[model samples]
Structures are given as structure tokens and as C-alpha cells.
Target: MHASAHVDTFARDHLPPPGQWPGLHFDLPELRYPARLNAAAELLGGGVPERPVFRTPAGPPWTYGELRARVDRLAHVLTGELGVVPGNRVLLRGPTTPWLAACWLAVLKAGAIAVTVLAQQRPRELRTMCAIARVGHALCDVRSVGDLAGAGIPGLRIAVYGGDAPDDLLNRRADAGPFPAVDTAADDVALIAFTSGTTGRPKGCLHFHQDVLAIADTFSRHVLAPRADDVFAGSPPLGFTFGLGGLLVFPMRAGASALLLEQAGPRQLLAAIAAHRVSVLFNAPTAYRAMLGGLDGHDVSSLRRCVSAGENLPEATWRAWHERTGLRLINGIGATELLHVFLSAADERIRPGTTGVPVPGWRARVQDGNGDPVPDGRPGLLAVRGPVGCRYLADPRQREYVRDGWNVTGDTYVRETDGYFRYVARADDMIVSAGYNIAGPEVEDALLRHPDVVEAAVVGRPDEARGRVVVAFAVLRPGARPDAEALRAFLTAELAPYKCPREILFLDALPRTATGKLQRFLLRARGDTGVDTDGDQQ
Candidate 1:
């Protein structure tokens, strides 16, 4: 391995051991990039002059030329005023706003690695991220400034944005002449995106300058196929990699514009789509299901593509959306480690229930525990390798993520003879009962088919006779109340008796992370306690 030519080698030095890294293969010509590359320049500089790039509800749209000028001024402020040298880590904390996007680009433009943190994060999570990334400077939203300051990270210099502070990002040096984009190696660390840490501590997933463009080139260009006049909108916060690529990189790569929404719930997202005539949407399956309830009032005719990731999309959700809107829902499975979508189906090739085949530049297969490929039609662990893979920031878990040069995504899937991948469940979400292995998601999907069930989650609980029995937690639609016996009968008719939940617990709402991911671990904890609050025990 060659030494990095970066000014600050903190990120490079802290990377996991070389032997733990998954083998990277960039066989595609489009995947190959120059040794020296700047992601900010590659993403934003190629936009058509005077074309709209970003738009919001409150303010006028920002054209490419105007955005470039702001990026240059911020780059100057980062390097000149904040003393951000090459490879230094700069933390960005904010909701999905135009200024936050600009700040992310400015960090890369100034040759610093951008560390994105979610706005909903508390002081403890903030301190952990700052400590892990060794963040030197921060550009935070005004509302989060007090919390960040209270975190008390050592030697962290903070600059507030969207406020009256003198050093606010909006009031920064606007007259600074165009600052040249930093010339950094293609493999240089450009962004350190922290994982959602649902299991434990958040780990930083390091992405290179070229890796940023590879996602847009592969998934966005080949799958979503955005047009120059298209408008992209979604609910994901910019802190998540799914949001970063869908809202910023993909749109910019195609010379399209993005609608930035600070708070995008089901109603807000639908309203924005109609108001802006958005053509592309990126959100979770849960959101798509929520959006279906009020589709009669909103005109979403302009929506040409709908991409769902961050979780497996149930067949019921996919069919419901398509039935309502007459638009095929694109289903994909991506990981923070891999940067963006590696497995997906788009356009006419999409299969409603499946996650589809690997993207053009990637290879995916179902593998046994021994890292050997499993026969088609057999459920096994999902492994993928491509131009992009996991590169953890000095964590021992890297060894678990990369095995035999393939990135082992902790998912179970079945590879059909037709070459499509059908998701079974997360590797840990499999339930073993009475010598029969069952995927909890399968039962959950069956429950979702019931009209009264708004959401469902299934897990296995210890049972003396069966070893483990299937248990379900459900949220019902307003004014709809189905008791445990009725739901049990429904599941028994839809699935095998062994797969039917022995107990059904109804809750007002299911616990979810900020990104709309179901917190199954919390549900599992509830199951372990054998407590039924709704008194639906059978």
C-alpha cells in the first residue's frame, strides 16, 4: 500500500488494517477515475450553467451558477478562515436544507473530509461522532448549536448557520474570489458517514472521492435514469447516505434539480410532490404505505420514478402503491458501508416482491455461512462485491463485514433461477421453532395484508414446548379494532399454522428510528419479557 498524499493523515491513519478491507474491483470503464479527483467538483461543477439545482418552498430556486459561487465562497471560508487543510474532518449538523448541502460540498472542496450527523442526535451521540472522527471544525444549524456546544468536544471550533450570529454561514465571506477545488487522490477519504447504530455504537463508513460518483453512475444513471428537467424529492435526512446520493449526487450528476425539505412527513412529502411536480421520489416502504391513505387529494401525475430502500419493501406495499398511482415502485437494498444501492430493479424490469438483480457494475450472490455460494432457490446470506464496499474507520467489526473479499451484508435472501433476489429477512431476524426455520418478515407481510393492520412486526419468543414461538406486534388503523383471536384466525388462513403468531400484541405505535426504520431490537426486548399490554394474549 502506498502512503497517502493528504495534508492531515488522521483519517487515513485511523482506517482499519489493510488485511481487513474487502477486495475492491473496478472492472467497469465508467468506474475508473483519475488518480487525483475532487468529488465536489465532479458532482457540482458539471451542472449546466444557469440551470436550477436546488429549490425550497420558502425561497427562490438556486441556479447552478449561483450555487457554484456560494460553494466557492464557503470553500474559501473553510480553508482561509477555519484553517481546514487537506484531510481534516469537518462535522456538519442540520436538517435537510440547502445551506447544509452547501456546507457538505464546501468541506470536500476545501480538501477536508465531511462528517454528517443527524439533526435529531443528542449530545451523547454528537460527542461519540466527534470523538470517533476527530472532528476539527463544525458547521451546525442554529437550532442545534446549543446542544452541540453542550457536548463539549475538545478543540472543536463551531460555526452556526441560519441564525443571527456574526459568523453564520450565510453571513460568511461572500466576496471571496473563486477558490480552486482541492486536488486529492481518488482513494482519499472524502466523507465519513456514521451508521445509524441500531445495534450498538455508530461506526464511520469511509467513502472515497470516486466512490461518491460511482453510486450516481451506477444506480442513479442506470436505474433511476433522471432527466435534466426532472425534480427529485424525498424524506430522508441528508445525514443518511441514502439521502445524500438520492437528493444531491444523483440529481447533480444528471444536471437535475432537488427539492430540499426540512420536515418531510407523509402529508408534507405528497404536497411537495404536487407543488413542485417532482418526478423522482426516494423513501422507505413505510412512508409509501402512509402516503397511500391520502393520495386522492394530491395529484402525483408527474412522478415518473419511486425508489424504496433502507428496508425491504413488502409485496403488499408495492402492489398497493402501484394500484393507486399506476407507477411501478423500484425496490432496492443498500447499506451505509456500500455508499448506495448495489442491488435494485428499475423501470419495466422491476418485480414487485423482489429486490431485483445486482446493479450493472456489481455482483451479488447468496452464500452459506462458509462464504461459499449457495444453490439457486435456496435461502442464504447475501454477499456482494463491486466498485464500492465497506471501509470501516479503525473498527474490528471490519473483519466481520468483509469475508473472503466479499462484503457480507447481514441479510438473508434467495436467488431465483431467473437471477432475481428475493429478500427473506435480516440474518438475525430468522425465527427457529419446532425444528422449522421461519422468516419473521414473511409473517409480518401476511399480517400487513389485513386491512385493519396499519403496521406489523414479528419476532420469536421462548416457549417451553416449541423451543420458540412466533409473536407479533401490530398497529391498527384509526377506528379499526381487531382482537388477538381475529388476527390469529386471519394469519392462520394466510400462512401455516406453525407460522401463525401464538400471541398478538397491539400497540398505539411501533418504535422507529429517526430514519423510519423499525426498531426490532426494542420489540424483541418486549417479546422476551412476555408482557402483553393490550391483554390480547391467546
Candidate 2:
């Protein structure tokens, strides 16, 4: 690797062994980046200085020149007054807004590794992520600093933004001149994205400067092609790579603008599409399904492209939206490890029930348990190889995710003869509810903390409105009665609201195998209903 600009070298030292990495391919011409590159510099430099690049509902649009100046001043503050150096992990906590986006860019510009987390995360979740990433400095929005403060990370320096406090980030004194971009190596780590802890412990996925740009060149440039005049908006939080790519990176790479919304429900998205003339949209199937029934009087004629992910898009949902709007939904599947979508279909190439072929710089296939290639029509593991792949920070699970030069995503799929991939189901026990990946064991652990709870198990049950809802079965102590709301309230204080169980059922005892192992499969089969240990309905 080229000489890195990072002085601390913590992120580089924690990366998985070189031999454990998946095969990387820079096949496309645009995928090849220079040895010395800064992703923030690359993204911000592409836009025309006079054109608007970011917009909020109540605030005026910020053009490229204005945004650049803000980033430069923030970068100066980060390095000059805050005593930040290259390779420092700076945590960004806030809602999705222009200031949050600017803070992310400024961290990259100052040669620091960004650790962005969701605003809805509780103190427990925040503490775990910050511990894993070894975060020292934090820049949080004034409204969202309460949780981060509650996290109680020792020796963490906190700075508030978007507030009138004396020590606010915008109030810091710094030079207004342009700050030279850090001469970071293309392979140097730029950010560490933590998974939702699908396995009960969040793993940080380290992405390099070039990897950040590669996702844009492959997916945004090849599949969901955007025009400079387009306005992008999405529902996913910027903490999720889905939102990071669709709402910010992809649009900025194409010299387009984006409208950032703090609360983007179906109704809000529809209103924004009409109010801002949004052209390109990114959301999950659940939102699209909800919007189908309320399209009357909403002027969505400006929307030309819609991208859906985070959950499987049903044929029924796709057909209803297409029929209502005369626009085909681009269904794709992506993982946090891979950074962005590698398989997608757009425009005339879309098939209603299948994910399209691999993007221009990616290759994908189905493989069996032993890592052997499966037949075209057989269901197996989805294995993909691309320029951007997984690199876990000090996590031993790297062995399970990458095998034989391919990243084996824990999703079962079948590749057809025509090269289209069909989604089957998740191969693991992780529950995906309402486009959010919620770990059953994590919720179970939270439930077990209650004094009345003896044993607990969580599963995902299909729901018409949310695609799936978290259903939990608990075996309470003998005198305790079943009160779902009480247990839900107990969980809300510890975990994110989305991770709380939507429905709780009482069971005499949790089912187990002969060796005393949890039989989650049995619970999944008996979802939404409680059954006694004797296999009889309660």
C-alpha cells in the first residue's frame, strides 16, 4: 500500500490480515483511483460551484462553493483548535441534515476516520460502538447530544453543532481560507461503519478512500444513472450505507443536489417530491407500499427514478407502484460489508421479481455449503466479488464472511439462466423488520434483563404493514402475568425503539434440544402464538 497520511495508524493496525481479504477487481476505467486521494475532495470537487448541491425543507439551498467553504472552516477547526490528527476516530451523532453531512466531509478532509452512528440509538448501543471503534472525539447536533452524553465514554471530547452555545462547532474560530486536502493513500481507511449487530455484537467494517468512490462509479454511474438537475431524497438514516450512498455520495458524484429530511415517512416523502420537485428517490418496499394508497393530490410527476432496497420488494408492491406512477422500481440487494448495491436493474432491463445482473465492476454467483458453485436454478449462498469488499476492524468473523476470493453474503438466492437473481430468504437468524436489521439475540438479551423474565426468544413474523414485525416469546417467573406493554417499555430504555418487540407472547418454557440448546427454528415456526414446552398451544 502507498504511504499513508494518518499519523496515529490505529485503523490500519487493526485491519484483518491481508490473506483474509476477498479478491478485489478494478476492472472499470473509472474504478482506478490515484495513489494519493481524499474521498471528500473527490466528491466535492465534481460539482459546479454555482449550482445548488444540498437543500432542506425550511432552509435555503447551499451551493457547492458555499458548502466547500463550510467544510474548509470545519476542517480547520478540527485540526487547528480541536487537536485532531490523521487516523483519529471522530464520532458524528445527529439526524440527517446538511450540518451532519458537512461534518462527515470535514472529518475525511482532515484525514480522520469517521464513525457515524444513528440518532435514535440509545446509550447502551452507542457505548458498545464507541468502545469497539475507540472513538475519542465527537461532534453531535445539539438536539441529539443527550444520548451521547449518557453513553459515558471516558476521555471523550464532545463538541456540539447547530446550537447557540459558546462552544458550538460553527462558533469556533478558524481560518476561512481553503484547507488543503489530506494526502491520504487510496487504500487508507476513511470510515468504519458498524453493523446493526446482526450477530449480537456490532462489527466495524473499514472502508478506504478509493472504496468510497468505487461504489459511486459502479452502482450510481452504471445502474441508477442520475442527471445533474435531479433532486435526490431517501428515508434511511445516513448512518446506514444505503442512505449514505443514495442520498449523498451518488448525487454529489453526478453533480446533482439532494433534499435532506430529518423525518421522512411515506407522507413526508410524497410531499417533498411535490414541494422540491425531487427526481430520484431511494426507499424501502414498505414505504413504497404505504405511498401507493395515498398518491391522490400529490404531484410526483417530477420523479423519474425510484430505487428500493433494505428488504425484498414483493411483486405485488412493485406492480402497484408501477401501475400508479408509470415508473418501474429498481430492486436491488446490498450489504454493509460491500458498501453499496452490487446487483441491480434499471430502466428497460428490470424484471419484476428478480434482482438485475451484477453492476459493471462486480461479479456475483451462487455457491453451496462447501463453497462450490451451484446450478443456475438452485438456491445457495450469494457470493460476490467487486472492487469494494469487507475489511473488519479487529473482528474474527472475517473468516465466515469471505471465502475462496468471494464475499458470501448471508442471503440465499438463485441465479437464473438469464442471469437474473431471485431472493429467497435470509440464511441466518437475524430478523429484518420494516427495512431495519434487528438481531433477535440482542432483543432477547434486553428482555432477559427484566426481573420477571425467566427465558426469552425473539423472531420476525410477517406483517401486512411493516413487511415483518418483531415477535417475542418470554417464559416469565411463576407469579408474573403477561403484560406486553410493560416489557416493551422496559426495553425501550435500553435499546433503540425499532429493536423493541412489537408483540410479546407468554410461554411456559422456551423450547430446547436434548443438549439444552435453544431451538429458535421451533419458535419461528410458532411465531405470533404461544406454545407450552409439551408442544401444545397455550
- Estimate the overall C-alpha local distance difference test score of candidate 1: 0.89
Task: For each candidate in the order shown, give its overall lDDT on alpha carbons.
Answer: 0.89, 0.88
Clashes of 1: 0
Cα RMSD for candidates in order: 1.6, 10.4
Clashes in model 2: which pairs?
A: none
Candidate 1 segments exceeding 4 Å error: 1-5, 533-538
Which lDDT tens digits does candidate 1 get at residues 387-467?
A: 888999988889899998899999999999999999999999899999999899899899999999878999988889888
Question: How far is 134's C-alpha from truth in model 1 (Å)?
Answer: 1.0
Candidate with the greatest lDDT versus the true structure: 1
Off by over 4 Å in 2: 197-199, 429-538
TM-score of each: 0.98, 0.83
